[model samples]
Target: MTNRLEQTKALAGEARLAVLTWLAEPDRHFAHQETGKPSEIGVCVTLLTEKLSMAQPTVSRHLELLRRAGFVSVRKIGRWSFFRRNEDAIKDYKEWMNEHL
Candidate 1:
């Protein structure tokens, strides 16, 4: 399991932070997706890349870190990689902050 410090590092930086914020309300932020419910299946990386205005590799790297940190969850539908925030883990983190920080 990843330590708290590692998860903290994953949440660092502007792009990654924006990613989490967008994922917090995928339906509102990424409402253009016509394939599936973003809240349930997650948003496509292509859409996220466009939203972030960053390279796919960069966004993918940020997502990978978040996935490892348990702040995000991913789903694969054929060739597309969909991503969404892990609300349970986020709530736990918030509660942890309230108690420890």
Candidate 2:
């Protein structure tokens, strides 16, 4: 469908894929810090920067691209920003691939 094509086009960008690839391996890209509950847990921007060995602004730019592509979600807790995978979007993308690819 045209909608799927548009989404695919957005996701095909380089920065978007890098963010998704990082998210695909949470343990590697993020630190396992307890937040009392899993729902409140996500990869902190600082942790992500350290893992990627990149500047904060650069990481933020990449995150912005992924967010725009519907591949990730972000939440702010206090002064820190946390990012998590948008599983539903990913699942839908997989289903679309199965049907179209």
| TM-score of candidate 1 against the unseen true structure | 0.93
Clashes within 3 Å, all models in order: 0, 0
CA lDDT of each candidate?
0.89, 0.72
Model 2: per-residue lDDT, tens digit, 1-101? 33566567768666657667777766665546454232446677777787677899988987876676677899888888878889888898888799977
In the range 1-101, model 1's lDDT, one tens digit per residue, is 54778788987888889999999899999888988989989999999999999999998998999998899999999999999888888887778779987
Q: Which ten residues in a row have the lowest lDDT in candidate 1?
A: 1-10
Q: Provide the lDDT at 62 for model 1.
A: 88
Cα-lDDT of candidate 2: 0.72
Report lDDT (Cα) of residue 24, candidate 2: 71
